[model samples]
Target: MSYSHLLLALSVVFVWGTNFVVIRWGLDGLPPFLFATLRFAFSALPWLLFIRRPAVPWQKLAAFGMLLGVGQFALLFLAMRADISPGLASLVIQVQVFFTIGLSLLTLGERVRGYQLAGLALAVAGLAVIATHLDATLTVKGLALVLAAAFFWACANMVVKTVGRVDMLGFMVWTSLFAVPPLFALSWWLEGPQAMASGVMHASVGVWACVLWQAIGNTLFGYGVWNWLLARHPAATITPMALLVPVFGMGASALSLGEPLPLWKLAAGALVLCGLVVIVVWPRLRTALLRTNA
Candidate 1:
């Protein structure tokens, strides 16, 4: 990745990492599925009027949107509602990194070489530290749902990769159109009318602001650039950056949510950083080493 696109990828993950806290706050005043519905509504509408549809096929775009929006956020939000810690949720979702690599290899015949695989192993070990040190907030039900969300996220990565390059902003906005109906449909079935209505009526200003940020900052900018990067680089290279999410999520949680920054989490963050360094630098290092020997 170029320096500029690397910066863009970092920005995307930062917004996404902080978004866990935002989702927690939003869910406090809104039901999971309904909040998810409103999130897409705010993300997609109005802009839909301004931006032209992307050149991708209708079915492909719709499938990508549903997976990206519903398969990811709806299940994720519901898991959080089931009492998964925001920090843990962020960490566990990095399972999508492995899922992406595996699916990319199977579907696209992409190869994961020495440094990438090694870095991935280190990152998974970092996650294992956090997982083994789980607190009361970690539940089997929530973990299962989040892993499911991660799988859909990995599949959605392939969708964007398969579509290749196009208008990323327009594509995000358009895919969101397909996502909204299903979210509302599912919300109605899952979150009862009375429960959903009551939650909306009692929503606080903090919740409203969080929802707006989640929509504009997280959805528009984060997902837009993420898709752009996946289109620009190989999936294996682009996906490793997600390991940074739990690091950022843990820090954000400590600051905003009063979650303790345990030593193990800090150590895990360091391991993740080392893993990212290997992913970023190993290619150039190997090339230079070969050149010197020659």
Candidate 2:
């Protein structure tokens, strides 16, 4: 990878890592759906003003938004609100990686490599440990919701790979546009107009700050740079950089929220990180150092 690409990847990891803390902080004052709604609303402002609508068909755009924006965040926020540890939540959502790969095979005809299969096996085992170790009397419903969010994320990934021929930033912008109304509608319907009204009126400035960071810092800058890098580099170079996000998420959550690092969670993190190193970094390093340098 070029130095510039490496730097961009690092920026994404940093922003994404810090986002977990922002979510936790934002949740303190804002209801989950309300927070998600306002987040996209804030994120959409710049896109509406500057970026043109994406060239993709309307159905594709709407589907992408439904999966990535409404489906993913709705469940994620609820899971967080249900007291799934932020760090653990970061770790768990990674199940999407495997799901994405699996779905890509079925839908996009992308082949899943042997090593990827191994990584999936390890991830599943790790999830078992995490789920088994959850606090007694904790229902799997919240965990199931988060996993469902991951499935939506996987579907969105496939959408981007298949349908996102337009500029990456533009795709995000339009999808967010398509997504915002449905999200707000869902919030209004389920959480009630009065609760949302009360939430807006009573939300703290700190909560707003959290929303801003999530929208601008994480969503815009983070995804913007990420899409840029994806356009510039090979998937081999770009995709693995995302693995670092969960590390940052877990660590930041633990530190910011005073969440514990159970022995199993730490072990699972090590396994996942090690697998990422093997899948992403090791191959690029070998190719660059041996083939190119030689």
In lDDT terms, which candidate is top? Answer: 1
lDDT of each: 0.91, 0.73
Clashes of each: 0, 0
Q: For model 2, what is the alpha-carbon lDDT of residue 287?
A: 80
Cα lDDT of model 2 by residue, 10-67, tens digit: 8888787668778988888888988888887887877668988767888987898788
Off-target runs (Cα >4 Å) in candidate 1 are: 290-294
Least well predicted 10-residue stretch by lDDT in candidate 1: 1-10
Q: What is the per-residue lDDT of model 1 for residues 147-229, given as tens digits with 9 covering 90 to 100?
A: 99999999999999999999999988899888899999988898888887897889999998988897889988999999999
Which residue pairs show backbone clashes in model 2? none
Worst window of 10 by summed lDDT in candidate 2: 231-240
